[model samples]
Target chain A: MHIRVENLTHIYNQGTPLERTALHEVNLEIEAGERIGLVGPTGSGKSTLVQHLAGLLQPTTGRVLLAGTPIHSKGATARSLRLQVGLAFQYPEDQIFEQSVFREVAFGPRNLGLDETEVKARVHWALEMVGLDPARIGPRMPFTLSGGERRRVALASILAMRPRVLILDEPTAGQDPQGRRALWEKVGQWQQETGMTLIIVSHALEELARLVERVIALRAGRVVADGPTREVLSDARLLRDIGLDVPEPVALLQALRQAGKDVRTDRLLPAEAAAEIASAWGLRRAGA
Target chain B: MKAIPIGMYVPGDSILHRLDPRVKMGVTLVLMTIPFAIHSPWSYLTLSAFIATLVLLAGVPPRTLWRTLRTVFGIAFLMFFLYLFTTPGEPLLAVGPIALTWQGVLAAGGQIYRLCLLVITASLLTFTTSPMQLTHGLEAMLSPLERVRLPVRELAMVLTIALRFVPTLQEEIDKLAKAQRARGADFTGGPLRRARNLVPIFVPIFVSAFRRADELATAMDARGFRSTPHRTRMRRLHLGYRDLLAMLIVLGLVLTLIGLG
Candidate 1:
């Protein structure tokens, strides 16, 4: 699903002494089947913007156009909008509350008022999508699972909804290197199969560079930069200015440039960056 | 449950805010007894005037105070009808299946008035004091009971922590509800169904609360927190002359009401 946030502003606790503006006139459009990464520091309105996209929060001013229709508190659009967007929050514990993994993943499908056979089928399918075997993990309790396992189960619960726009907010949080890699790979595969519009919100640019093609960096509740992932993450000054840690490849390329070499910084992957430097050195030596 | 009006603290700089929270709590206890000693309309008026003056001295926004009092009025209104129908006394008239009596009418009005007064006194104490101040005040008041080998400090610590986590728990609950709602959980059903839906939220909350408590215990232990230690206070509670004068005036009023009754 395509999402258009036009002049969106969200002021928390409005008309009170403790009023605060969380999002300030944030305008963006996420095209269908687009893999976008939302990068920002804490309290920079990334969560607020995603919540607006997921229909969990209403805009204080302006409006959110999801699939070309305005969503009010009640009506046909708002009612059906909930299933169109799936948001897996930053904390796995926030979404994983069901006792059994089967019941947990089936929560969304059951809410759709599906028959038992369909609910079970979706639960099994979702579990497998997150790289968990349904036959073994279905009957077990989610709380009893390992940290990465619990995270995947929480994700599977949201994936069961089969949302057109899938949002994973720091889904690999607290995961080890191997676990994070596996989880992202599973997400990549699932998105490829379903062609869902993927928006991954993370502060880390390294993991995001591998996942999303487009990067939208938010600083102080405003979209500071929005472009291709390689183009956005390549600018070390932009990453540092936005208070985000520069990815390793971007940092390495910057160092190479500073060391008096003509290396391209727009390469996101470490291997691509190394190859770019080798090719640049080859061209330099050939000219010499 | 967005927020209970009674739990809300209205920030102000009036004498009530400056007064010791212990003294304010004591005044609440003293004011609660006035409802039991009512013998005539003069006493009610006196109590009302006295409560109103104290609220005025508190200097809290009247609109904020009214928001707190609204809940009390709702309870009192329901109690008025219950007392009118349930209490058996001198029959004054008949309303449908129930007989309206003179005693019942008097009882209903008096009880409603008394209920409203007690709530006002209690809410006044909370309105002017923050949770931290309230907890410290409670601890100071309960300190004397340590002579009986009571874990007063631990009890106070528990109270303080519970008060502190109320907002945290509320935030967690809001997040959990949002997460579930995003996945198509319906909370707008009947009360029973709403409650059933809330189970998913509460189970996670209880689990997280326990984990947080465990982590908090470790942090406190690392910081040399002892249950029965000599702890120094950063903001000590001192009773000023104003506190003494307030106590004297409240005592005098209670005594006067007693004598009149």
Candidate 2:
């Protein structure tokens, strides 16, 4: 579904002394099948905005439109919006409750009023999409799995719903490098197979750089920057001024350029940075 | 959910807030028993007025107290009707087949008033005293029972921890509920279906609660927490003139109430 958020503002604990404006006059739009990365420092209202998109939170000021329909109007439309927009929350495993992984992943599809066979098929497809061996992992207890497996199962649970728009908040948060890579690969494959619109919120710049084509940065409840990934991630001074770390590959290339090497600092991924550095060094040596 | 103010404690700088919690605890206990001892309408009126004054003096918002009492109104009104129809007394009015008695109406009014007073007074105690102070007060008040081999200190500690975790668990439940709701878990169904839907939400809460408890245990152990007789407190409880004055006022009121009853 195409998503549009117009002048959205969210104030937590409104009318109370502890009321806090978590988001302030935020405006953004996402076309169907767009892959966008949402990055921000802690408390930048990234999660709040994402929650609004899924209709989990009502906006304090403005409205969120899903396919030209306002989602805040609660009823059948809200239920359909929830099915259309899947939110894989940060630390999603913390809310995992089903006994077996299969049942856990099947919960969302079952709630969609699908038949048992369809539910089973979705579960199996989701598990396979997340790179988990369905036959081996399906019947195992969810709580018994390792942290990474649990995280994958949580993602699979959301994936089973086959939401048209998937919003993953910190999807790769505490995983090791291998786990992160594997999960991202699965997510990429899933996105390719389904053509779903994806919005990923993360602190990992490298992953965001490699995965999403567009980047949006938020600071203190306001959108600070929104542009192509390379344009946003390569701006070290801007990100550093906001107390956010630029992606490591971007930082490395910029550091080399600052040290008097005629290198391209706009490269965001490690492979791109490596190729840029090799060609820059070779050109410099030949000229000398 | 965000609009509802769930907690009772309202921070303030009042005489009740400053009074030693042990003395406050004693006063509260004595005041709670007044509803039972006071039988006459005049005495109940005096006690109710006294509790209302205490609530005001503590700087507690009347709305906060009423928010709690509002939930009991249906039950209280039901009890009033139950007494009106069933109690054996002189009938004052007739509604078709049911005879409403004057004595039954009076009895129900007294019962409901007494209950409101009880709940208000209890809510006042919680609103004025912090959970930590309540814990210390309970520990100090029940210390004498320690000589009888009771685990008074441990019990108080448990109370304190449980009180502390109430807000934490509430937040966890809220998050889990939202997450479940986002996954198409509809709670607006029949009672049976709602109950069935809640299983996914609650199981995770229980699991996380256990995990949190384990972490809390480890954290407490790291801080060298242990139940012992020789433990020292960071804030010592002492009875001052204000406490004595408050106690004297409650004592006089209680005596007058009993005499009138």
Candidate 3:
């Protein structure tokens, strides 16, 4: 589904002495089948904004529309609206509570009123999609698994719904190195197959740059930068000013330029940055 | 969710806020009880004036105080009307089933006045004192029980952790509920169905809470909590001149209230 956030502002615990504003007049449009990365410093309202888009939170002032219909409305449109956008929250592993992995992964499809056969099929597919073997893992209690495995189970629960939009909030936070890469690869493949809107929120800029073409940077609850991945990541100063690190390759290019090497800083790929740095130093030695 | 107004602390820099929590709590107890002795209008006026003065000195916004009062207004009215018909006296007016009596008017008026004073008095203590201060004060008050092997320190720590977890647990429940709702789990249903819906949220919360408790115990042990029997405070509570003055003033008011008869 196409998501639109218009003039959105959110305040937590409104009308109390402890009340705080988390988001302020924020706005963005997300097209279906688009891959986007949401990057921000801590307390920048990134999670709050995505929750509004998913219809988990009602806006304090403005509105969020899914496919041109308001998602927080009191009528029937909102009743089915939230189901279209699947939100895998931060620390999704903590959300698993079902008795068996089969029931756990089947939670979403069952809630969607699918038949038992369809639920079983979807659960099997989603578990395999997240790299879990359905036969070995499906019959066991969810609490008996490791944290990483349980997190995948929680993710499969959301995937069983087959939502048009999938939002992963720090989905690979505590994963091992290979586990992270494997999970991201699966997400990429799933989006390619389904052509769903995919938004990933993470602090790992290098992984984000590899996955998403569009990058939106937020700081202090406002959208400070929105552009293609290379363009946004290339602005090393802008990212650093907002207390976020640039991709490692982009950082290296900027460091070379800072040392008066006259190297290109707009490069995001590691091979390109290495080639640019070698040529700059090669020319410097010849001129010297 | 909005903060539960009556028990929530409103941060302020007032004389009442600086007073020791024990003294404030004691004064609240006294004020809350003195209403039982109040029957004459003069005594009620004195108590109302005293509470209003306390409210002014605390610099709490009138609107915030009104919220505390508004919550109990319905209960106060119910008690007032119940007293209006039940208490016997000369009949002022006769309705179909009940008679409004002159003595009933006095009795109900006094009951409502007393109930309001009790609520305001209790709310004032919490409004000026944080949960941490309250727990610490309770610990200090109960330290004497340690001589009898009552495990007072652990008791206080339990209370402190429970108080701290109130908000953390709230956030956790909110996150879990939202995650479930995202999976097309509708929360709307009849009573049994609603409870059944909550099972998905509450069961995980219970497991998480237990896991957190285990981790907390391990963490506390790692920090040398079990190595020493004696405990120390980062900031010790002291009874200063203000606490003594507040005690004397409330004591005088208590005497004044009792002597009104």
Candidate 4:
């Protein structure tokens, strides 16, 4: 579903001594089937903004429209909006409470009042999507799994809900390099297969550069940049000013261009940059 | 998620903030006795003036005091109303089914005054003292309990950890609630439905709390924390002239209130 936030503002602990304004008149439009990356430093209100997509947080002033429906309206129900938008929180493995992985993955389907057969099918399908063999992992206690395994189980739990819009906050955090790559690959495949709108919040610009077509940069609760991934990553000054490290390849491409080389700086990922460099230098690989 | 406000002792360089926590504890104890000694309105007024002067000298914001008062306002009102109606005395005023008496007013007013003084004094102590200082003071006060094998050190350690994790747990709960709400879990249904809805929230909260406790235990073990009887502190607390003067003033106040009563 298309999500639009207009002049959204959120003030926490209003009228208290610890009152804080987390989001300030933020405006953004997300189209359906679009892969968007939300990039920001800690405490930049990225989490606060994304929580509004699923109606988990009510806007203090403005409004959020999901599929042309204002989610904060009098008739709006967060429960119905939630079915259309799934949010997997940071370190979601900590939320696991069931005895086994199967039951844990089935929790969402059960909550949705699905039949037994359909719930089982969803659990199995979700586990397979995350590259975990249901037969091998289903009966295992969730608490006994390794960190990466638990993370995948957490993702599978949300996937069982089959939301049209998926929001993941740092889905690959605290994972080994191999695990991170595998998780992202699965996420990419899921998005493609289901054609769901995906929003991933992370500090890893390089990883986001590989998956999302567009990036939204936030600094102190306000949108600083919103555009194509390549365009956003190539803007070195803007990225550095917001405390985000531009992707290595993008930075290198910028440096090469500044040194009077005829190199394109818009390529963000390493593979894309390598291809551009080969064509620029007119070099032919042995395999090609 | 907002950090738990426990141990959120605001950092300040005021005289009250700098006072030794042990002295503060002693003075709080002494001040608590004045309410017991108060019989007439004059004694209560004297105690109220003393407390107000101390609060003013501490330089705490009036907003902070009101916030603390608001927390117990309901209970204070309930106690006052209960005593006003239930106490036996000569009737002073009658309104519909309710009858107010002279003795009832005195009793209710005294109870309310005592309740307010207790809450405000405790809040003042917490406002001026950091958790670390409070824990240190507790340990010192309970040191003699070590002879009875009460695990005083371990208890203090547990308290310190619990205080430290209050904000973390609150943040976790907030995050879990949002996460659940994002998955079609409604917590605003009818009474029965709402109670049922809490299943998802409480399950996650309990799971995370246990997980956090385990992680904290591991972290403490990794940091070489052990149950040792003799351990050195990074910061030691000492009582100075300010503590002595404060203690003497509190003692004098208590004595005068008792003598008048």
Residue-level lDDT tens digits of model 3 in B87-179: 988999998868999999988988887887888889898889999999988888887998898988888888999989988898898888888
Give the RMSD in angstroms, all C-alphas superposed, for model 3.
3.5
* Model 2 alpha-carbon miss at residue B103, Å: 1.9
List where candidate 4 sits over 4 angstroms from the true fold. Answer: A13-20, A74-78, A115-118, A134-136, B1-8, B91-101, B147-150, B189-199, B202-215, B218-229
Q: Give stretches of model 1 more than 4 Å off.
A: A255-260, A283-288, B1-5, B39-42, B85-107, B222-224, B251-261
Candidate 4 per-residue lDDT, tens place, A248-272, comes to 8888887888888898988888888
Model 2 chain A is weakest, by summed lDDT over 10 consecutive residues, at A279-288
Taking the tens digit of each residue's C-alpha lDDT, what string does model 2 give over A30-130?
A: 99998999988888899899999988888889999999989998678767876789998889998799889999999999889999999999999999998
User: What value does the interface RMSD of model 2 take?
Assistant: 1.5
Model 3 segments beyond 4 Å from truth?
A: A257-264, A271-288, B73-78, B90-102
Top-TM-score structure, candidate number = 2
Q: What is the DockQ of candidate 1?
A: 0.59
Q: Rank the candidates by DockQ, best first.
A: 2, 3, 1, 4
Alpha-carbon lDDT, every model: 0.85, 0.86, 0.87, 0.85
Q: How well does candidate 2 match the true structure in TM-score terms?
A: 0.93
C-alpha RMSD over true interface residues, each candidate? 2.4, 1.5, 1.3, 3.2
Q: Which should have the higher TM-score, number 1 or number 4? A: 1
